[model samples]
Target: MPVVTYTLWRLSLFAVTLVVLVWVGMGSWLAIVLAAVIAWALSYVLLGRQRDAAALHLAQRAKPGRSAPADAEVEDAALDAAERERGAA
Candidate 1:
């Protein structure tokens, strides 16, 4: 699953767990705090590997000097020209 979908799933699970805890009379404020901590810990433990993989994928995709085709150079020149025109105007 995508990182976003995984995250949302975890969040919804956390919410349901917290609601159940509160419904069981675990004290509203304490349940909220404990649930947040537990959710964060569980998320870190369970999703750490996937998060690391996503980070690595992004890092590889962003490897230097590998982006865009030669057309990017033309785009840059056009942008520079537009900037110069704006300054002159």
Candidate 2:
């Protein structure tokens, strides 16, 4: 949720800047490029809290043994069993 919120905020900033630049008669490509750069800078400066939250969420999610899928657990068990059988033979 935090990641989603941060993404939405960045995209909104980009869109608004793009619209303004286009309205001022900037070329489409230039407006898009400028808007992206401006949005990145603004988000970096203004969205520190949100960015931190999103980063923390991602870090937690990527930790080992953190709610892995059931199929993955089953596959691990099967691999262990196969290794045990080979060792016994």
Candidate 3:
């Protein structure tokens, strides 16, 4: 799935989980606080993996340029292109 779709799905699941947890007799304040903490921690873990995946996706999308490590070369080319574009406008 796309990153945005996956992220939305994960957030919806987390919301549902929190609702279920509170419905099962946990006190409102406690449930809310605990759920927030757990969601934050889980997001922290998942977001790292998501960021790495996004970086890899971007590297793959970059066009081939000079001969070096493919990702590094692509990154260099992209940077150069960005710099030239900025200089022009």
Which is the leading candidate under lDDT? Answer: 2
Clashing pairs in 2: none
Output the lDDT of residue 28, model 3.
84
lDDT of each: 0.79, 0.93, 0.73
What's the TM for model 3? Answer: 0.41
Model 3 clash number: 0
- Candidate 2 overall Cα lDDT vs. reference? 0.93
Better of 1 and 3 by lDDT: 1
Q: Write the per-residue lDDT of candidate 3 for residues 1-89, one digit (tens) a residue.
A: 44675577557657876897788988988887777777777767767777567666667656565334578677899999999999999
Q: For residues 6-79, what per-residue lDDT tens digits would candidate 2 score against the true structure?
A: 99999999999899999999999999999999999999999999999999999999876778766778899999
Clashing residue pairs in all predictions, respectively, total 0, 0, 0
lDDT score of residue 70 within candidate 2: 64
Ranking of all predicted structures according to lDDT, beginning with the best and ending with the worst: 2, 1, 3
TM-score of each: 0.57, 0.79, 0.41
RMSD of 3: 8.2
| Clash pairs detected, candidate 1 | none
